[model samples]
Target: MLFASRPTCIKRLLVIEDDPLTAFDNEHTLKHSGYDVVATVDSGEAAVAVIASEQIDALVLDLGLAGHMSGREVARIARDRGIAVLLVTGQCPVDAEEMAVACLGKPHSAAALVSALKAVETMTCKNKTPRKVSGLTTFWRPEAA
Candidate 1:
């Protein structure tokens, strides 16, 4: 079945999780949900580097990363660059409201992940202006003077 208001652009997603199994699961879920899994990295440093260089549309980030920078730090940088982020952690962070679009607790279902992705897509689309109709003209008529 086709969606009535599907996003016009394909979303490129980056997964940043330290655990190998979790990373694999996240990648699998996103791929099946129709997002392009750009790269899955285990360290915050690597994730940050990829975010800087790649054309990523969103990020699925783990709170405790393998490297020096925590997921919160990485998310902050990604957000500054206008990339949408969803934080996944064993326990949700208190400051997630300021940094991420949403936070999912660890051991979440595939359905939950898909739902969060859709929310981010909708948020991104809202920032863009609707397409202008072609060959349309508006003439302003003066009231009788």
Candidate 2:
């Protein structure tokens, strides 16, 4: 089990979604929700580039991206770099529990997004996993010792 403690409250976000409308919605929602949107990119390549250069706190990712690199790949890279992930997808991957702080399914509301992110903060910072949060599948990590 990994014991490293990353900052639980994510302030800066990188959004990776190919759909123009969804991307715009996510960017706008996150910004209005008081999260700094570092960049909104459609491809994992661009996401990776931003990850390399920016001090991003989290990645809001979509599964069906239009590029060679998949969302899973980007999530791995982000996690490796100590960035949290919040997956917003229609088809949640089987291994999402391993890669993301939470999986927020598609057709979700803004309230659900913010709530799930707050759950993330609770889990990571407080080491308390909340149960049955709406519109999200929160992940688990071993408590840091």
Candidate 3:
């Protein structure tokens, strides 16, 4: 139940970012691009809480956060719960093993962010869950040939 009118068309997204400004910018970009932002959390703990409470469709995660668990951990939790994740990280750690649909390097533009979100939406539309998104869901893994 993401969009009030067309839930099947546009899905809800959760943003896990510690920086208020970055989160706001991401929210603004996604909202303007016709996506429903369900929630924005500044920590992994809050992210876990919201994921349990809300019917979320996708997640936009930043690598580093203020809590004990980083965004990689958040992505892992989301993947285990069958939620789509779009990772935005300054550094793509080699050890990350969870799944993520989209990964944008830091200092990305609003347009790039929008495009990444659209990719997530398309994957969700096709597969209903990110885990089934044809190799795009595997975190830190190169695209499958």
Give the TM-score of each candidate.
0.79, 0.88, 0.77
Tens-digit lDDT string for candidate 3 (1-145): 2323233444788988998999999998777667789898899999999999999888989988988987878898898898878888776566544457667778788766765665566555654334333223233333344
Reference-based lDDT, each prediction: 0.74, 0.83, 0.73
Q: To one decimal, what is the Cα RMSD in angstroms of model 3 from the true structure?
A: 6.1
Q: Could you say which candidate leads in TM-score?
A: 2
Candidate 3: clashing pairs of residues:
none
Off by over 4 Å in 2: 1-8, 142-145
Q: State how far residue 54 of model 3 sits from its true place (Å).
A: 0.2
| Candidates 2 and 3 compared by lDDT, better number | 2
Number of backbone-clashing residue pairs for each candidate, in the order shown: 0, 0, 0
Compared with the true structure, what per-residue lDDT tens digits does model 2 show for residues 1-105?
Answer: 121233346788899999999999888877777778999999999999999999998888997888899999999999999888889999678999888988999
**Under the 3 Å rule for N, CA and C atoms, how many clashes does model 3 have?**
0
Residue-level lDDT for 36 in candidate 2: 86
